[model samples]
Target chain A: MKKNFKLYISLFLTTLKISAFTFGGGFVIVSLMRKEFVQKRKWLTEQEMLNYTALAQSSPGAVAINTSILVGHHIGGFLGSIVTVLAAALPPLVIISIISLFYNLIRENLIVSYILMGMQAGVAAVLCDVIMGLSASVWRESKTFALAVMILTFLSLALLSINIIFVIVACAVAGVIYFGKIGKKGLKNDLS
Target chain B: MIYLELFWAFFQIGLFSIGGGYAALPLIQQQIVNNYGWLTVSEFADLIIIAESTPGPIALNAATFVGTRVAGFAGAVIATIGFIAPSAVIIALLLFLYNRYKNLKYVNDALRGLRPAVVGFIAAAALTILKLTFFSESAATVGLVNIASLIIFTLALIALRKFKIKPIMVLIGSGILGLVIYGGLSLI
Candidate 1:
């Protein structure tokens, strides 16, 4: 019981600490999470951690949320997933709640609005960087066919205004077919 | 009534938004802005800024903010839970079976196909935000260039790429720049 209690506390506190500065974004938290779980606690091997990162990226919801759940389950069990989920979800809930309390006060302020507007522009550029990085990595990893999939996805979303869910599903289906048949050179580059 | 809707809406967001947080932005924009009318176009953009700057996942922050705006404390609670439900549930299920099927070659190929598309989706979302920020609402609209915002955007991008600044720092810097340029000058 005492060991279980200790494990739970570690799960909760570690996730809380890791998520505390998720300020940069969800993906950024991976490094901090690595430090805590892999380096410090020694819970996960490097390969395990990499697998978790890949799975977290592919899974639904936020990367942080999926990661914490995976790590929690890795350490504990079903109950561990719950604890990790709560741990991952708690800090943001608290912070946003505090901000929400002041939402009216800040929303009414002209300066905050201006700052947010400016930040929106900044956000756009940052997003552009994210896109460039994503495309470059994708190109390096898989080459032309992957680039074709990306372009088609972009065209439908940007020009056709198709629903994003539909776009994603269609792409997944395409992935299954294209890679299933074109298994010549591409098979060596598969992530699994 | 709104609570039920909030739960359903965010649940869909949590379920369908594959890839990760940034990829999720487009779906959240569609639901919150176009479908529900929870926030205006500009307000939704600000939501991204606030969500990006705050600690935690952007999706969690967004659900909490929009929930609180629409329904208050209860709203926040349900929305956040709704947002996290799928990841926990589906991932739990996957964890159970992952050991067996993790090595399947077909699975690898399918995921390979999905990667570029995920990148594409993220790029599209970024472009959508860029259009909203740079131009007016649509292409036909004239001269709503938001020049001051453009300046911050350019500077922040430079600070990020050239200076190797942290994103939080960029956001804080943009906020200050916003205040100095817009507030001190009384532009608005």
Candidate 2:
């Protein structure tokens, strides 16, 4: 347990540092996470990492936290998860806490504003690239249907202010229906 | 008990937040601004700005920012812990059961359908961000400079995709571009 605790602490710190420095949100963090968990430590297999990502994306909170907790738990169990969560949360919590104290002082600065605007542009670009890249992956698996849904959904939300939760819930329901239909087809095929 | 409630509230947010942190923004806004009345919309907006500018996940950053706002340092800790608790629990449970269900065919088919929806959700999020950033009808007229900014953003994006450059570097380059434009405008 003691040795496991130390490993958890190390993993937590690794995650914290990665989370702290990697900007442009969750996608950048995914690469950093792969480096740490997959390339360096080999704590998780590629399939496990992909599975964790899927679970993390669906489950909520921050993908960062969910990924950390999931990865940590996989490597070291319950205590590992606890330590990883702390590690993942602490750096940002501490940094943001300090920023909250001095946010007003920084708010009106021209240079800071310029930097943020730049970062925002960069963030927007990165997000677009991610969407495009991920779209190809989606297309590969299911061809035109997934691509069409993706583009359509993007247009709907981009043009109109439709609530996102409605989109996700609809998709999840669609998944259930597709599977149910497939199952019925399979059973009939088996009998026939 | 207050802390527990705070934890639980954030936990629920964490649990239901698909498409990562940004998707949770509306939910957080609803909970903090509408339901709890913990912070004003403007305050929440300010926190979001800071959260975005800072180097962390927006959700955790918001949790910390709003937590501190609500209950100081302890509140920040409570909120952070609350936000992460559910995912940790759920992940562990999933890991334990993953092998048992790994080869199930219906499960695979369901995942296939769900993958497209996830794509839809992400695309939806990207659209929301674009709308938020670009199309503010309340601003009356779009300025020439803003249009220039958009063009520059597009070029920067093309460069990014072509070169596979990191976003931070592009951000710094854009920051320099902004300085040159705005500072030149002031001189003119």
Best by DockQ: 1
Error of 1 at A5 (Å): 1.5
Tens-place lDDT per residue, model 1, A23-134, is 7667788888898889999998989988888777666788888988898888887778788888888888888888878977988888787677667778887787778778
Off by over 4 Å in 1: A184-192, B136-143
TM-score of chain B of each: 0.86, 0.66
Candidate 1: the clashing residue pairs are: none
- Predicted candidate 1 versus true structure: per-residue lDDT over B1-188, tens digit per residue: 99999999899999887777687887888889889999887777778787877888888999998998899878999999999888778776666667768854554666777778877777777887787877743222247776776778899889887887877788888888877877766644
Per-residue lDDT of candidate 2, residues A1-192 (tens digit): 788667866887898788778775776787789888998989889888988877776555688877877787788877777777777777788999998777667757876655555444455565677667767887897786576666665565555646555655565666567667867998999999
Task: In angstroms, give how far residue B129 of model 2 lies from its true place.
Answer: 4.3
lDDT of 2 by residue, B47-85 (tens): 555665678888788888888877888988888878777
Error in Å for residue A19 of model 2: 3.6
Chain B TM-score of candidate number 1: 0.86
Residue pairs that clash (backbone atoms under 3 angstroms), model 2: none
Write down the RMSD of all candidates, one decimal each: 3.6, 4.5
lDDT, each prediction: 0.81, 0.68
Determine the C-alpha RMSD for candidate 1 after optimal superposition of all C-alphas: 3.6
- Per-model TM-score of chain A alone? 0.87, 0.69
Worst 10 residues of 2 chain B by lDDT: B136-145
